[model samples]
Target chain A: MRNSFLTVVIFAVLVSATYFYLKSPEIVQTKLEVLKENYSKPRDKKPVDHSKFEVLQKQFNSPQEVVKTCMSCHNEVHKELLDSPHFRWQRPVYENGRGVTYLGKANAINNFCIGVQGSEVSCNKCHASFGEEEAMLAIDANAENIDCLVCHDNSATYLKGNNMNGFPDKSVDLAVVAKSVGTPTRDNCGVCHFFGGGGNNVKHGDLEKAQFHTTNEIDVHMADNGGNLICIDCHTTENHNIKGRLFTVESSNTNRVSCTDCHTELPHESTVLNEHTVKVACQTCHIPTYAKVNSVNTNWDWSKAGKLDANGKPFETEDSLGDHVYKSIKGTFEYARNKKPDYIWFNGTAEHYLLGDKISEKETLLVLNKMNGNYNDEFSQIIPVNIHYAKQPFDPGTRMLIQPKLAALAKGEGAYWQDFDWLKAAEKGMEASGLPFSGKVDWFNTVSYWPINHMVSPKENSLQCVDCHNSENSRLAGLNDFYMPARDKYELVDTLGNLMILLTIAGLFAHGSLRYYFAKKQK
Target chain B: MKEVLIYKGYERFWHWTQAVLIIFLAVTGFEVHGGYSFFGYENAVVYHRYAAIGLVVLIFFTAFWHFITGEWKQYKPTPQFVKEQIEYYLLGIFKNAPHPTKKTVLSKLNPLQKLAYFGLMVVIIPLLVITGIIYLFYRMPSATNMNPLNLTNLEPIAILHTIGAYLLVMFVIVHLYLITTGHTILSNLKAMITGYEEIEEDDDHHKKEEKKV
Candidate 1:
């Protein structure tokens, strides 16, 4: 009896200790404390608070002055920044016909506003430079041109001037931003990134403003109530070259990040689930829907742009969902929210269609950049992507995709926004890009794929077995190379198997019945 | 009363455990094969794996027992009463003809029982176990790393395991029926359960006092 009492007392103490262990603050509330939209910056770590530095005290004349002062102390870092793609907006790529060709956003044509050749003043707002950074023509960027305050600002209030040649807005306090420089936060990177392709959540469907301060339900890594990871956390950088590459612009697969970087080769505890990781990417299952909070530009038709109202001015109209469906300067658009992605086998390499490349196919939807992989490829896995489709102009005679000059510095400059003429703008843009325009505009359907890489839901919200294992319209319904047990079966084999089982049952019944009848007669 | 020890301790223990495990595996296994959704797919897969491992363990113990005690010879079908045993099951049993082969402690199984058990031991059971193990362990051509066994596709192994399972089910049904064909309908079952059987040696076929060994 005494030993039994001692055992019970020991068990009680163990239970009490475990109960209090979970009740401790660190274990329960760390997830909340570390993740707020605008959490208090750790000023203690700023040993050199630039607020006291005399170099930043006199930055008053212009945005260039702020850059000169920033370079006064950080010239070495600024020099590295100038060589980055973020600064020059171009990179050297090894192409098929041309061994090593220089290409970038400046000359490369997308299904969106075509190219940045003649729209430098407007597009350079997002470019990582101070002023006049156009690489279509030779770029003259140096250490003084590097925009350090844009990426390193922790103040989260720096705004770039719209259509002002990459300068900060006139209202921005250059001294205040210079005094508060630190490592880039989600707010700093997201200021331009979340607004890529002109507006919020329009370029990559998975990236949006909601990610700046969302809960774990939308994005587990970047959510204000989740891991609160910044851009550079996974896209790690060395000497200003980010590790991750986007398939939309990049051609090489050398620089990429994967879930296996931190997780095990087989992350799932169950072997059944781990078996799937070989043929399926983590993002394919983790990111079930893209554009979770805002509507993304799924369709854009440039043919409908320049539609002036009776008052002779371009006007904007909103759809019933309050999303802009018609921007007279950009055209008719179709936006989609919480959209399921198109699944494709991608081995991470992509082949982009460079400008001046002839298109031989007629009356077909052109893929501007096609992801490279097949079911037979050893390195391929099913990945989810958002295909943004568009109807844009191309040269009918030259069979080349046309890039129209979309912005103007002055009136009647042959820019599409000023003259409202496609042929004239195409001529000017082609002249800038050193490509020929056929003097005729014909719009064709084009698409660019953007792989979903963010807004991962919680583990509890992962796909259940039936999501892909069901017979009807499975998420992987398009992938049919191999036999998936629940989702695939040979109809003939199944019928024969069921019939054989049935025949056995029938035979057993008949034999058992006969035995019972004969035995009853004898009895 | 005349009673004899028909089954040893380990034999009875192994047989009942194997029986329970096989039945449970069938229920869960068919569900995993998309036959029905009783336990749900995930639970069915998990439970089927556990029970399959249990069956493999039980088979190991049974093999050791059979080898050590030399009880494996009991499943060898004897040529002496093979014809008479078949005729008895087909025609003699309904007309009250005496059992063609007498039951003894050394030769507990009848000629027909010997033949069926022998077939099951060598063919159907081995087929099921071998194919099931391959199906469980086989990997695709390059799933994780290099496949050591060089077994690529799972289609053939899956179909073969499925056919083996169906045949095992058929054998079980027939075996359950044959157990009732003893002196009384429950006598064979009682012998298996209690490890004792009372056989009347006289031709009268009436109830008699019994002694159990």
Candidate 2:
């Protein structure tokens, strides 16, 4: 009796402990209220009204004069800004064969825009520098001309000039923008990042113009009424060097931010869900579909770029959803919104397709990048990606991608936009980039991967087990290297398991029937 | 009816409790293996883990009781009546012939029962419990990155556990059917429940009574 009572006591204690274990991850409403009260919204704690300062009150006649006045007071900050990848347009990388090479926005080849090697004047609009027009390979840029107000401006009216060496626009009041300088806002970062590839939601499917005043359905963190978190909340910057990087321009995994910086590695209420975090990233489930607002550029076929209207002038057409379906100067395009992302195995490292890298002849579909991990790699996890396909020009003889001059440096200087001639544009573009372009130009299909890391959904909208654990239409159906329950079946296990149980049932039925026959005969 | 003490109070308590717990475990365990869903996936996983821990504790107390009272000797197989027990189960039960061996307090199990129970305690139970523990804690991060030994790759361990679970299901079915082979249809179950059975006045008990007198 004593032992039975003790057993019941122990059983109750174990059960109660397990109940609490399942309940412990939930936060009470009152505790969340306290957390919200204590949580510091994105703002500079030290308030300094710059309008009252004596230096800022002076008339800033020109863009260079505005920089000259700001340098007089907050000096030596330009040194940190000069060394950043934002200003230099490249990061110092140690390649496998070549010792150390600078490869990034300037020299790296992407499917969109090709590169910035010979087209620095137009591309330098987002380069975070001023008056460094032809910085294709220039490293020792003048720190005296760094544009400080582009990020520090609180004035919302500042705008960079269109194709004028990244100066403040002709309409911008330089004096007003200089006096309103405080810290970077969502608008300051979104002016370039949100509109990366010429328009909204073009480069990254997760980022777009709607993220400035976003809703919870688009992003849980940056939503205007939700977490209201700015980019730097989880991005945690040290000095002028920001704490994140995108694989499109970067080749290494050293300086990047992750969800684990703010959330724990195992943040789920259930232990089963936490175990999946080891082999799967947080974004793979949280961000089920990207580009929730506007349609992102999915395909670009540059082979149809030379088409003209009846009047011999360039024309453009839009799809039913207002996406630019065809453009005379650029090419044909296909866009999609609320799209499910493709998956890849990544461990933060990337192998970018540099300018001089040779393209393989056997591979019909050339991937610009995205070969950083394998299934056997210990540091790898399945991450979601948005693959943008493009039909771009390539050389048949040398097997290298052709960098055709798309925009004109001088009028009719072999620019494809000016003359609409492929041969001459290839010649001038290769000459400017220091490569020998073959006379023959051919078009080939190319694919590139952009990892989607934003637009987190709410907790209730996360994927269930049936999403990836089912036999059909599994989200992870592409990854077949490992055995997953409900998806993978081994022949030996199925056969042995079935035989063992079926034999037990057959034995019972035969024995029971024979015994009944014998007993009835005896009676 | 001559009612004899065929089971002790503690033995009845543990046997019925173990049967209920094992059936509950199999129901939840198979669901987690993607067989079918009685409970939802999340609930199945949670309850399966809890029941596995409960069975481990139950086995601890059972082994302690068996060792303290020296009742574990009942399950030590002897090859003397092995063939006779097999033959009786195969053919003699249908013809209403006599049993191959007699049951007593000290020797509760026959030759076939001894072998099955011995393997159950020594092999299958331990296999399921150990594999279950590794399955529960697989890929769980520790101070040294993972577990103490840092064992990964859950495929092999899960397969082994799954095989053991199937074998246990087979054992439960066969064991349930054999309970009807006693003197009456439900005599064995009644003996376990009430700690008494209408045993025959056989020579084994007569000899013990003679020695006591």
Point to the candidate with the largest DockQ.
2
Candidate of highest lDDT: 2
What CAPRI grade goes to candidate 1?
acceptable
All candidates' TM-scores? 0.85, 0.91
lDDT of 2 at A511: 94
Model 2 lDDT, residue A456, Cα: 91
B1-213 per-residue lDDT for model 1 (tens digits): 488777766567667878988899888877766646888888787678767776776677668767877888778776767898889877787677888766776667887788888988888888888988877776555545734554746667777777777777778877887787888889999988888899754343222211211
True contacts kept of each: 0.17, 0.36
The TM-scores of chain A alone, one per candidate, are 0.88, 0.91
Per-candidate interface DockQ score = 0.25, 0.42
lDDT of 1 at A46: 59
Please give the TM-score that candidate 1 achieves against the real structure.
Answer: 0.85
